[model samples]
Target: MCLYFLDCWLRTERYYELDDGDLALFESKREAFLKKYEKEIKAYRTERLIGSGTLRDYNFSSLPENILKNLDSYPPFNGYVYQNGILCARIKIEDKYFYLPPIYDEDCR
Candidate 1:
């Protein structure tokens, strides 16, 4: 289960990269991406709580707010990265780190 989440997180990081830094564009793209992968995301959330005694359905729509609320709790690190005509940023959610507009390389496996 941990591995699955890690994989998804990594994939999201890679997928989040944007060629332009327009946040409105990013939000639109993010929404579309989430909607397209809604089923998989739900399954991931469900598996995440398998043994945690909490069965409440997780809402991805609230992710941005949730991330913002917990942003200061973690150590500050350089979140933004610009490379290969794309820009990305690292974001934290709970203990996990996610890249917004994720870093990517064609050579990456």
Candidate 2:
């Protein structure tokens, strides 16, 4: 699996800084949400957030305080590696989960 350390732009109000335990909880919830509405979430993201509609070079540190720092402990992130991977963001709408780069690896997580 390929892991890219990216500048991720997470929604503050939606997803706050999650510690180790909280991160696990969030991932479990996210997995369940995906199993149910993955297709719908994919459709929304493909139409609105990726490809032609995507936002590149987005400032990922727009979150408040050390939120970003805490989120870095999540999967597929190993701190910033000077890799300019375009915007990585995760948000949920109407009880549906959506993300730009879907399916992250937890190998070295």
Q: TM-scores of the models, in the given order? A: 0.22, 0.18
Which residue runs does candidate 1 get wrong by more than 4 Å? 1-63, 73-75, 78-84, 101-109
Q: Please give the lDDT score for candidate 1.
A: 0.37
TM-score between candidate 2 and the true structure: 0.18
Off by over 4 Å in 2: 1-56, 73-109
The weakest ten consecutive residues by lDDT in model 1 span 47-56
Compare the candidates by lDDT and give the number of the best one: 1
**Which lDDT tens digits does candidate 2 get at residues 26-63?**
47787764554343343322212222122232233454
Clashing pairs for predicted structure model 2, backbone only: none
